[model samples]
Target: MTNELTDRGQERRDSILDAALTVFVRDGYHATKLTDISREAGCSVGTLYTYFENREELLAAVLQKVQAEIGNASDEPLEEDFNRISYADALRASNRAYLVGYRANAKVMALLEQAAHLDEQIYDHRVARIRRYIDRNRRVIEQLSERGEIYPIDDPFMFTTALSVMISRLAYYTWVEGFFDDSDETLERVAKTIDDIWFRSLGLKTD
Candidate 1:
């Protein structure tokens, strides 16, 4: 009985967060109200309060949820033997993972970007999330460098940071904001274009 109650409670929380993303994505951060989220969530305002104390609290929860989603997806460390995979194959695989993850959570991602600009707390959280991923990618780049698979870099951190932000920002504006024609062919083309740019910067050649 206790287990069932906990499971159901978590489900309800997830639903509320999902609804929050929907409204945040549609209306953006500055304009969204708790009632807007409640209505979108199909729950009463009181129910929303039961889970989140205030607007700030809900926004915090929403940002954390987005981080958790991406954090989980990126938790796996790169293989120890990095050279086993071809450079182009590695680029394609990483690009696909990033693109798919961004697409899956575009709404939350878009909301976070808008909210981060206005909210100091949220800005810190967003920065932390990016830093964590960049640190991990830095290690991977180092391992690849050890094998001479990647070009020498004086600053792995900045290199990874620049590349990550470039692709991620482009993904957000292009796919999340629907700025581009994201039909299957177009998205595939976008991914290919990104892969090529990334390869050229890293001096990786595809056979």
Candidate 2:
């Protein structure tokens, strides 16, 4: 929907999306208003309408932006050559990256979960998005097994799904629910624990 905008127009649209995210995180999706976003963006409600047809469209755009940021945050680990690095190190790096991304988007992710319960479309999108992560990681596990870097698994897909769910729940509790302090020490401890699980489950040597 934003394809035809000039560079300045696109910038304005991006600002609106950022503002929407801030407001949504602060006041929540159901409680947020276009005027709140406009105020945060230092624009008028009319200007917001210029970028988005309604509050729903604006929110969807904000959600898309958040999703993109989260995706980018963890992409670096995927590009690493596992042959050059130990599998345990790679898994630790990947887990830390994923947790960092999840921590950054924690509030918005929680908001997304709330929206999912109320909106079928959001629910479906959330489910599909998680499945995509599972599928991607399952492929990675299969490749690592084929390379004989990890033990052969009878059901890599299910195993990946389980690990993904465990990590996701840990992130939700640690970040969204504030189960632990957001300290570097805490992050390191959590990452190491996750690494240990992955290494043990895959029968990879940790030392």
Candidate 3:
């Protein structure tokens, strides 16, 4: 539906999406209305309807935008050779990227948690995102095992799933719930702790 928009139309659509996200984060998802988003976007309710079918669709789009922003913050170059990097360095980089991204999107992440419980679509989307991360980590674990870089696990997929969930919960606690301070020093310490756990779990020697 959005594919046919001209550049200006696309911009308007994006603005509406941004407004929707802002409102969602400020007010809980069920409490937010299209009128609220329209006011936030400086557009009319009719204009919002032109860009989105309904509040649910707008919320889904906002979720997608948040996920895309997080992905951009955390994604590494495809061509980079993970095998050549020290395990500790690789783990440090990954943990730092994830925590930084989570911190940047802390409010939205909290909103997502709320929406996931109230909306089936949001819940499915969140589950799918986690599955994708687990699959990616599992593949990496398999590759590293093949190269004799990490200890052979009895169930790589299960191990990856457990670790991925742990990291995600830790990020949620530290960032979304504000369980700890968000200073750079605190973030570095969190990343190092995650690195140490990853190294020990995978039976990789740390330098």
Off by over 4 Å in 2: none
User: In candidate 1, which residue pairs clash?
Assistant: none
Given candidate 3, what's the lDDT at residue 188?
A: 83
- Model 2 — which ten-residue stretch has the worst lDDT? 68-77
How would you encode candidate 2's per-residue C-alpha lDDT over 81-195 as one tens digit per residue? 8668765666677778888888878898898888889877677778877887787678768877887878888878789999888877888888888899988888888888877
Assess every candidate by TM-score: 0.78, 0.88, 0.90
The residue-by-residue lDDT of candidate 3 on 42-151, one tens digit each, is 99999988978888778888887877766655556322576576645665676677788888888888888888898888898789878977886787677678879898
Q: Residue 128 deviation, candidate 1, in Å?
A: 2.2
lDDT of each: 0.76, 0.81, 0.81
Candidate 2 RMSD to the real structure: 2.0
Top model number, TM-score = 3
Q: Per-residue lDDT tens digits of candidate 1, residues 27-90?
A: 8898989899999999999988777777767887887877676655544324424447565676
